[model samples]
Structure formats: C-alpha cells, structure tokens
Target: MDRALGLACSLQFLGLAGAMIPLPCASHAHVWAGECCPVFWGDGSPCGAATGRGRCQGVAGPGAPAGSDFRARWPSYFFRRLCACRGNYGGADCGECRHGWQGGSCQLRHVVLRRELASMSPGQRLAFVRSLDLAKRTLSRRYAIYASVNATPGAPLAFRRATVYNVAAYLHYLGSKTVGTPRGPNYAHRGPSFLTWHRMLNVHLEQEIRNITGDPSFFVANWAWQGRAACDVCTQQLFGASRPDGRLYPGSVFSSWRSYCTNDGPFTGNMSVICPLGNEMPITRLNGWNWDIPRSVFRGFPSWQDYYACLNLSQYDTPPYDANSRFSFRCALEGFIDPLSPADWGIHMHNAVHVLCGGTLLFSHQAANDPLFTSLHANVDKIFEYWRRRNPRSRYPRGQVPIGHGANDYLAGFIPVYTNEELFQHSVHFGYDYEYT
Candidate 1:
C-alpha cells in the first residue's frame, strides 16, 4: 500500500465524514450578482453588448499610489471601463449567469456541494483529474490576464490569453503581492481578509471549471487534513506524486503540466512582481514531512483539537488585525501564531499544511502551481464556514488594515467587484456548500 494512503485509512476529520451532499441554503435575503471585466480584454462581448445584461462603466476603488503594482485594487490601474452587470448576470461580459443562478435566462439555482478528496470514488476521481487537465489546457473564455512587453513594473499593460487554470494560479500570486507597502504585507494572507479572499478564489475556480466543462454540477473537493498525521493526498491516485528532483512521477498526467508565474520580476517590493507567460515552468511538489519521514511540526500534521479550538475564538479579528492579533480566529488559523502554544512561532493550521507541502508550495506566490493548494484552501474554506456558523452575529472588524484588505476593498485581482465582507455570506448564497463538517 502507498504509505500516504495507508497512514490515512485510520484518519477521520472531526465532525466530518467526507460525505458529498446538497447544502441547505441559509435564509439570507440576497445573493451575489455581476462579474468584473477589464475593457481591454474581457469576454470579447463588452458586457454582453446589445444583450441588456450590462454596460461598460468607469473603474471604482481606492486610489493607487505612484509606481505600485496594477493589481492593488484589482484592474483599476489597468483599465478605466469595467462591466456593471445586471441582476443574476455575471462574468467578464455579463453573458453568463450569476454564481448561484444558472441557465440562459439566469433562472436556475445551482448549488455546488464540494466533496472531500478521500471520499471520491474511482470514476469520480478520474473525471476530476481529466477535467482539471482540461482547465489547464484551455484558454480562459471569460477573462484575460494582464501581460506586458517586459517584466517592468509599469510596463505597458496588454491583455494576454492564459490557460483557465493560470487565472487561478495568478490570482493567488497577485494576492500575495504587496499593494503599496514597501515591506512584506500582502492582500490575502495574515489579515482579516484572508478567509474572505480565499473563499472567492475557490468560488472563482469552481465557476470557471463549470463554464469550461459545461457541467454546472461540477464542484471542487477538500483534503480533510485535521485528523491525518501526514500529507496523505500527495499520491499518484490523488493530487500527484513527485520524485527526489521535484518532478512528478512519469505515470501522472500532471507530470507534463507546466505552471505559470514561476519566477518573480525585478520590481521593487518585499518580493518582486511576477511576469506571466514567459515565466512558465514545470509543476512540482514534495511532501517534506510525512508518515515515514516524521520531519515537520506535530510529526508532519495538524490536530483536529487545535483546529476546533480556533473555531471557538469569538472575534473575527482584534486590534492590529494582521497576523499578530491574538484571540482572533483569523490569525490563529492562518498559522502566524500557535494558538495552543501561544509563545511558539509554530505554524498552526493553514500555513503548516502549506509548509509541509514543500518545494513549489514553500513560497506563497508559487504554491498554487501544485493543485493541492486548491484542495488545502478548500478545507480551509470549510473551516472558515464552520466558524461563521458558530458565531452567527459576529461581523467584520472595524479598523484600518493593509491595502487591498479593507472590508470593501476589491480582492486584488477579481475583475468583477468582489469585496472582503461581501464573501462573509454563507456559501449557499453563492450557490455552493461544503458537504463535510
């Protein structure tokens, strides 16, 4: 038996059995509407022109400081005209239905129930692998990435065609970039916006897959790592397996898969900018800590006990709402501090998983190169949703934060205006739900 799977057979996530089921919708009054599109290279229809779905409008967001990266408030710096979509309409051109509602008329309620990785059947697993490969091979139909003549910071912004999966990878890469700060602060991680920003990532990938595969029921799955004592899903049968040199096994389809945004640009910042397309490299990963190798923290895995403890944290975030805010669930779960061993700088939940899954995953900018990043975040999303249920009336923290992390700040690369707080609603509102605990 494979060591990863063999060690995982005894594992069971707390309160979650990896069952796939329909999510019950919350009684929330409204749902998300509209999509973000840059006028330069949108859906090519310019907000579904002559369709009455939307029209081009001027960009809206906080002002960008001079010489900063364009993705700070998303496409605000790149394009002046953005799509203002109508009810139940969304996407780059407003030609597609909103997240929860599908159909040509935007009248169907499509609730995606994301499954757990280990619970997927053999056939389902194969289909998922093939579908993900399809996403990797096909160019995005609804959106385009901002490419430039060179790796220059203010290089002339030209829209370029990128594989659908690269869009997913680039979102994370941009999210990790410092908006205007000279130091290392970023939009996604180590802040109150962490959970909300990541939530939209999963939603974006799933919706893009649905659009690409023409399968509205298509959903992503999570790796329930809380109960496992190692990185169990890194295998030929699951995400993929890699050899000593950091290349995937010959038998895996992902072995031939190349990733975008591999190298960083020379731009000034904590970590420089990432130039897409020309920087393509092979997808790679290695579970530095595992069953046989008990190398990393907690013998290479996190405990369900610590995970559940984070859920009980009352405030969404406290003062100085970055990674240091204690008693704040966002900070603890982000692995900036060990909630249990408060004094130690041990990686706790989400960050630990990323660290243990080393190589391409060691750096936040390149982590998404390995598809397991999505699975990890899927589980993270589940935990965040669980926290929401636990604290129903708790709202977003009211305090200044890093750029691109404000309650109403645009998720660094989201073309259609998505905000940090807008994602606080139940996943059901977005037409999706987690089947596991």
Candidate 2:
C-alpha cells in the first residue's frame, strides 16, 4: 500500500486494460562489441588531449574567446579527426603526441580484441546464441546488483537517469571548457547549459550512427523503469498518485530520508531514495511507509533482499515491509534495426553480455570491475533505441518525461528550444547493423 507500489499498479492497470499503449515488440537483436568503459570523464575535458597535433584548422589558438565559433567547432573537429585515426590517442588537440601509442597517425600498438563477436558466421551465431541464452538464465537467478551494494555503507548506488544526465552534462562542460579535473587547479569551467550540451552529445552520437549506416534511421533505444508499485494508500493520498502527475522523481518514502539523500544530492548512495513531484505532500498521513516506526510492528527494515523475497514469496514474512523494489528494464529500438546496418548489433550484444556478466559475476564481490560498469552503460545506451520504438507515441519535454505541476514549464524554461520531438529523433549512441544475420 506504499506510494510507489500504488502508482505502479495503476500504471499496470492502465497498460493491461489498453488505456495506455503496450510496447510494440520484444527485443530481437543484441549488441556484441565496442568500447564498454566508464564514460570517460576527460582529464583535460571538452578540448581534445593536451599535447596532440596542432589545433583544428583556422581555429582560435589556446584560450580562445568565449562564444566564438571556434569554440563551437572544437569538439566536432576533435571527434572527426580522432575517429578518423581510430582514437589511438587522446588530448587537448587531435595530435600524435599521446603516450601508450605511437606512429604519426596515433595508432595503437599492442591491444587485441578478445574474440571478435562482429564477424561470426551463421553456424557461429547459432552457437553463440545458445551460449548467451544459457548465460542469461544463470544470471537471472542471482541477486540484484543494487541489493548487494545497499547492504553496506560507502557503496555507490546506481545513478538515476536525471542524475546521470546531470553528471554527463557536467563532464561535457569540463571537456569543452578544457577544464582540468573538477577539483584540480587552473580549472576554468563555466558550467555550460545542461540541456544544450546533452542535446549536442545526442547529435554527435546520431551522426556517428548515420556515418556507419549511410542511413539516418539507425538510432538508439529507450530505457524506462516500469514505474513504482501501486496500492490503496498511495492513490487515495500522496502526490504523483496518478500518471499525469509525473513518473520519475527524486526523493524517498520519508521526508527526513529524502532530505538526507538530496542534501549532497550529487553523491547520495541510497537507491531507495528518489526525487519525484511530491515534495509538498504531507508525511503525517503516511501510516505504513514512514521510517523510524517501531521495529516490533514491522519486525525489521525492508532491505533490498526483503523486497526481493517478498516479490517471490506467497505471503508477507514480516511487518513494516515494502515491495516496490522490483524493477523491469525496457528499450527503444527502431531506426537502429533498419536493413543493411553494420556491425553495431555485435557491439550492442557484447555490451549486454558485459552487463549480465557483471551483475552475476560480481554478485559476491564487494566492488564491481571497471570494465563491467562500462559495458553495462554501453548496453543502456544501446537499449535507448529499442525503448523509443516500443513507445513511439510517448513524448517528452526537453529530453525528459513530464509528470506534474510546472513539469512542462520547468523543462521548457530550462531548455528553451528543446522539445520531445527533437530529442526523439536522435538520442542513440550508435547505429545498428541488421547485417549481423
């Protein structure tokens, strides 16, 4: 009867009753290869590497004036020049002056791809699919990654979409301003427009897809959390009790917990804490969802395991329990699956492998491997294309979904030219290749 579950049940009811559109299709293709790494927060951001070839042609020299056209052209120029040379090196300029690489063209010398998934023959594809299916089944039985992380303090929780978007925007600014690390000396970051940079990056990724496919249809997929749970206590009370109220918020079940989570908003580790549109909703009426209630009534705190256990259990095992922890992932993929794409599917499939493997392989470990995290996000980016296709009519304002009061206005004011249409056209990180078969 908590608020999140109540909301989810309402959404489910609407979806099942055909009040809302159902997803158009299930996932058909999988990604198999590519750079799955921590979304590199560049050391000398926005600008290319520091000691590379000379700056772009006809561009401003070091410390170019602000709002200059040269400043605008830098990232594009760097991406093209480096991608041309396969990104064997990185710095402020797209030069051949980086370490861990050699040659005038900045070619890498020693790295080898581990079992290229891109060039598999038909027979190989069948074998790989069988193996992948088995692997997924094995993984589905493991503990949720967030569940383990929440067991102890200091574990970093998964970044919500808005927060991750914010982080990416900040990193984009740092790179564009050529700021040293966020906390380093001589940093000159003038925080850029979050919406502007986010859109720019989306464009950049879309172009990459087009370049590979010679077609613009290949795009990214949409990835949405299947909203919170629905119950009696949630709908009759609380803000966001309905769909039009807004979907993803940033806060928690209790005011105190939400306040603690967002106090240092950028670094909160409590995944259960969320921020939505119910800030003004009173907590006094929260008969069942409040924290600090007596343990005797509830038995124990509803840890991640409890939620999972409750999900599978036939009956409630204890009191003071909440069951909104179950989450399902979906994607947007349409343009990406057009005819005659490229090897992008392999790359995407590889990303999924990394994600599934990371979650299961690291189930018992305290820390996740760096490569695994990268691959996981790579899968997330790839899935965006799928999400969009599944919910073609779903719209957004300024690259975000609207839910409650001032929601549209808030996004519009924050991003004047941004609209759902513009965002929908190009949010993918890469193109797809139907040529895999």
Candidate 3:
C-alpha cells in the first residue's frame, strides 16, 4: 500500500512539475550524463575531485546475523554505491569540510562548544531565541522532504518545501516511526541506536542552523536535568511562557510562531502522503512550575544520586538491547529502567525531563515544534558524552545489533546517510564537545 501510494504521489508530482526534472542532489552539483545521482556523487566520483577528498565505492552486503531486522527498511542491497571521504573532508560529496574542521583544504579544527542555556546572558539568550524563531520561518536551502520515491525510469520524485524546524521534526519522525516494512517497530529507538541517532540529528540540525544564520560558531544549548524542578529556560526571555489563560504572552517571540505537521493520520499507513500541513497554531507552553507528574518525590526532577547510579553502570547495554533491559546504555541513558528495581519501571533522566516540560515537548512527534526540544536533546547528548568519557574502553555495539540499529546500516530519511558506527566517536571525529558548568 505504501509503495503504491508513493508511486502515485510521485507520478502526480511529476505530472505537475514535468517528468524530466532532475532529482534533488545534496552536493549542489548538477546531474551528470542523465544518471540517477546518489549522495556524494558529484562531477565524476561520489566525492568530487575538487580537493581529492573522497572516492566512489561499492556498499557491502549484510553479513552475519543473517536476516537481521535492521535490513528491513533501508535495504543496503539497493544502495550499493557511496562516496568514501578521505582525510578531514566530510559531507555527502566531500563538498564541505567535516565538523570542527574548516578552510579551503579542510585542515582546521576549532572548538565547538555547547553551553548550558540558563548560563547565557540576557542579550545572548534573546539572540538565541530570536534565531530559533527565524529558523522557524526560514526555508532550508539545500534539502527538501520527498513525499514519494519511484526508482523506475523517468518517474517523478514527489517532494515539498519544508522549514528548518519542519525538517528536524520530519527527521525525528522518520527515525522514531517504523518505515520500509509494514507493522515493523521503530528501529532508531528502544535499542542501541537511540543515542547515536539523536546525535546525528543534532549534528544535522546544527549544520542547517549555521547555514541559515551564517554563523559558524552557533551551537545548540543544553538543559541540565538533574535536581532542577523549574523550566528555567522556558520564559518570554527564551522559549516563551504562557499566561494563566493558556495563551502565549503578548511580547513573546514564540507567540507568533506556528507549528507544522500537526496531523498524525498519514503516519499510520503510507508515509509518502505525509507532508508538513503548515497549520499555524498558537505556541503551547506548559511550564514546569504549574504541572506535576506522579513521582515519589514532590519535585519532578530526579535526584543527583539517581543520575550518578545510572552513569556507573559498566556495560554499554545488556543482553536483548531493547527498551526492557536494565543496566544497558539504551535504557539507562533514556531514564526508563527503574533505578529502584534495576529492572522494573522508573523515570529519572531523559523521559522525566520531557514529561516535566509538558505540551509539545511531552509528545515525541510534536516535541521538535518547541525550540526547547533542541536544548533537551543536547543535554541528553551531553550525558551520553559523559558516560563515554567515564568508560573510555566501552564502545557501541558492533556485533549482534538489531536490524535498524546496526553499525553500518544507514540512518533512514537523512541525506548523505550516516551509519551508527560513523557516529560512535562523539567529539574526536565530529569536531564538537560539551562543556558543563
């Protein structure tokens, strides 16, 4: 059903936009000799020859674990060709330098710092909030969300324009929702890829914002979750606060901000028809102070001891790497495994913070609509980095990983697709690190 609907949308889009229209390429390079261009394919090699950055290579077939679940959605067999970037050169076609590295030859490494949101001064906080609002209105220059895909010859590729925030939301949906196979569970979450997937998402978002704002130093802010009950960043000064009547304050920048993709109907069946509705609604702010979730302690935030205990878990993830397992990185970092029982139900970290935020931030699908989502995830990423630093020898699951979370499996819906393994090194390879005060 999904494949057929996707084909129909592709045909319709082609009919309206002309069949011969070239498919979108991320490298900003023109189609070469009328061939369907894969990511990183520019001029000749997958990575263009501008600086001898990378070369085109064949993708390897799935090995071991035989018929693993990860291969269900993004069939690596179909996408057999890819660009292998060399040296510090990165990106889809080696067109741009890797994170932290810059200049013509891609030989510079500068510090990319992510700071706590509450620590920023009043002026800096105001600029950050305005930048987020601007990003909401700004259309992405390089990418578009394709509504459908038809690999057949001369088939039209159905696509729609999306704002910077909309793209982030779409990426989140694609990662969290089941795709490719019907009735399949989400591949990115409930497994080893949870942290890795979001890390890539943040990296992609940061790059987009940098392009939009033209500020190379811009980085997402983190929110400290332990022992803090109030949504300190949720104010007219930052993400915006609401009045007692449940409306945005008059002077808040987010007051005029609108949300996209509010409709959840298309997600149940074929995702090809899912496009940003662009339905503008008043920003919903459920401040932390007013709402209360059920917990043993009165304050919604987790105790510092609970956080330290999870951090001390030795294994990266336990057997059966799904959400149910305890003492694993996936469940521990997610704050789902009950610290009290170690195997039963408990919420202390990431999930607690989301529930405490309420409104759009509480729901996984709509969370990105609120700019605070970025800060929340940045802090989560910071926690993962902290764990990695503490256990320097521990590594991401390399063998026997679930289907969608495999080391080499391509992340769904991301252009210039990255594998989970490629994202294992948080700061060293990617060129960014977290700083806590």
Candidate 4:
C-alpha cells in the first residue's frame, strides 16, 4: 500500500510539472473564448471583429525583482501576445462586457450578493441545488478540455467537450496540481495566494453559473465554518443526507448528480477524461459515525477562540510565505500555524471543515468534485475579508511570493487572466460581497 501510494504521489508531481509548461502560443492564448488564428500573430487585430471590443497586443512579462523567491520559469517569463480589452469590454476575445458592466457599449455597474447557505430559505436552497445540477448537465458553450499538454494543434483527438460544472471542477483539480518548482508540491495551496486563488476560483464559477442559469442574481453560497459543527446543513432539505446504509436519499437533487474528471490514472495517460454517469455516490465517512479523521471533542469544528485568534492576527502574510511558517495570515487562517497542540487532537479552521466534510473533500485533487466545495471556500474567503477589514492597512505581498502567486502573474486557464494584485479587493473589482444573514 505504501509503495503504491508513493508511486501515485510521484506521478502526480510529474503531471503537475507538465501541466505548467507554457504552450507554444503567447499568453493571450491562455484566455478562453474563440479560436486564435496564429497567422495574425502581432497585427493587433481585434479578437472578435464583430464585437470590436478589444485589440490584440503584446503580453508583458512580470520581471521579478531581485531577491524574489519566484524564478524565471513558466508564468514569470511567460511573455506572449494577448487581447487588450477596450473600456469595459472583457473576455479572452473581447467579445463580452466585464462582470459588473452590461450594455450595448458596456456601460453599467451591478452589485452581487452572496449569502450564507445555512441562512437561505428552503426555496432558495432548492433553487441553488437545481442551478448546480443544471450546470453539471449543461455543455460549456465557450471552452473545450485539452486532451493532453503534448497534443498538437491539428491532432484529431486533441480536445473534448465538457459540462460547465466539470470544467470548474477540472480547473480546481488542475490548479491544485500545478507546481511552481520542478521539485516542489502545488503552488496554489499553502501560500499567500491560497485565499486569492480561491477568491478568483469562486468568482469564475459564480460567473459560469450565472451564464448557465441566465440569472444575474445567482451567487455562490458561503458555508461559515465557525458557525456550526455537525453537518447540520447536509440534509435532504439542503445538500443531501446519507441513509443509514450509506447512500443519499432518493428525493435529494444531489442524489441524481454525477461527478466529473475523477479518474486517478497514471500521470502519463491521456488527460481527456469524463465523469461516470450514474446516481450520486454517497460521500464516505472516515469512521463509522464521524466524517472527520482523528475526531475531536468538538467534532471538527473549531472553538470561538480559534476564530478570535485568527481574526486578531495583524499581518496579512509574513516572510517565507509557505505553510510551515508561523507568522503568515495564510497559515493562521488555515490553522496551520496555530496555538493548539496534539493533546487537542483537533484540526484548524479551513482544514478542519474539509476534514469534517470527509470523502472527496478530504483530498485536494478531488475536493472540488463535491458540489459543496464552492460554499466551503466562500466562507474561507469571508474570513479573509473579515481579517482584511480588521487590518485595513494589510496589503498583499508585492514580491517574494511563489510563482503564479506574484502580484502581476496570471492565474492559469482564466480568460482576461486576473493577476494576484488585480484580485486584492474582492468587492471593489469582482462586484460581490458576503452577507452574514
């Protein structure tokens, strides 16, 4: 078992490194929407001529400052051509208006509200679940999944169709697997960028859901980890509950939901993958009754003091901004650098919630497969927002961050690719705020 686990870990590392390899095209190719005609490389043509919303331009590389932790690799030196959106025009091909703006000429401002899932009425919860299911079955109109990193442009089986929900889940999985250094683990997690990366991720999914459901009011629900402990919201009335026999109730919407991109095959295998078609599989518990591993006195929920301690931290993030550090906002919020000891037998805030949910949520690669992943992270973002409000002067690190987490570095696979610095103010830029009700 140990040997097999070791091999899987090794392959996952290799796959992660390969995925971060820059494609032959420029940085603009990283944007989604419309096909790129390579022949018109630097002519500065509009991405979508019909829209006339943006023109192609040279992509700028973030010249890492001296003494920076980021090396000149992948995103740091990923200089390429890209579309420069005009005014409020956005999207990879400059074919659509930016998030808050919507008009013939992209002149409007809108505010989106995100509420706690547990606070939602039964009707609202039902609608949210239905929207998620619809997203799972609906084919993505703008994007296609690449079969492999090595796939040639004209290869017959280079791309495959994917549902919007699957694409979101796959992006999360890929983000978790992306390695900054050839010899290290994923750069997306356990760093200053952890909250920022997830903030962008939730925004992306919320927009996708809005597009799919055609409801501009739709927002991802936040699950406040500090609010409860017993998985009270995991009921047939909300997200489904498991039967004594370890199966979802027949009447629950999630019972009919299927997971996508769940294959754990060797890294060398084809990347094009799909979810199995079937009824929702029951999320497994670690022990007979407890969903969390190493069950604690509070059943995986942190005490009020835990929340107080994290919220009271003064710095956004300290030096050596990785998980092992004892001084980072990222580590503090994640419960990694905490005051607790082994005698507590308890996990910290963000991780405790993942463990409490168990099954797919317990693993980084498969956590997003669970529909609840979005809401879970929403709450995490809320905590970050809370901390930010408390420490109004706290600023995101401008230098020495891991690759892809740098101030100007682009997040992989996002259209109109957002940099870490661009994502600093969630409500100001993304047009969304967390409502505590």
Best model number under TM-score: 1
The worst-scoring run of ten residues by lDDT in candidate 4 lies at 1-10
Rate residue 260 of model 4 by lDDT. 50
Per-residue alpha-carbon lDDT of model 1 for 203-291, expressed as tens digits?
A: 88888898789888888887888867668877887778889877888888788887777555544133333443466777777677543
What lDDT is reached at residue 255 by model 4?
A: 73
**What TM-score does each of the candidates earn?**
0.83, 0.22, 0.81, 0.78
Q: Compared with the true structure, what per-residue lDDT tens digits does model 4 show for residues 1-437?
A: 00100001112111222221212232233322223422212234556544566666666445644331212233323224656777887765666677777766778876687898768897898899889888888987766553332323212222445778877776666666534332233545767778887888888778888888889899888877685646766777777787765456788777776555454343312223222223334444231235334444333566677777778767777666655556566776665555243223224777767666666676666677677788878888988887877787778887576666777766755555677777777564686887853
Better of 1 and 3 by lDDT: 1
lDDT of 2 by residue, 1-437 (tens): 10010012211111101000011100111001111111112334222323332332221112333331222223221112211112554322232223234455655342211122234354543443333222222321101111111323233232122222222222222222222232211111111122222333443333323333343342222211112122221222121132222221234222211110112133222222222212222222111232453433232212333222222322111111111111111100111100112211111121122222221111111011111222223233333433445556544332311111111221111111122234444232112221111
Q: TM-score for model 4?
A: 0.78
Query: Candidate 2, after superposition: displacement of residue 220 in Å?
Result: 13
Model 3, 190-252: lDDT tens digits are 678888888888888888788889888888878776777677777778777877644678888
lDDT assessment of candidate 3: 0.63
Q: Number of clashing residue pairs in every model?
A: 3, 65, 5, 0
Q: Rank the candidate models, highest TM-score first.
A: 1, 3, 4, 2
- Model 1 pairs in collision: 35-416, 36-415, 36-416
Give the clashing residue pairs of candidate 4, or none: none
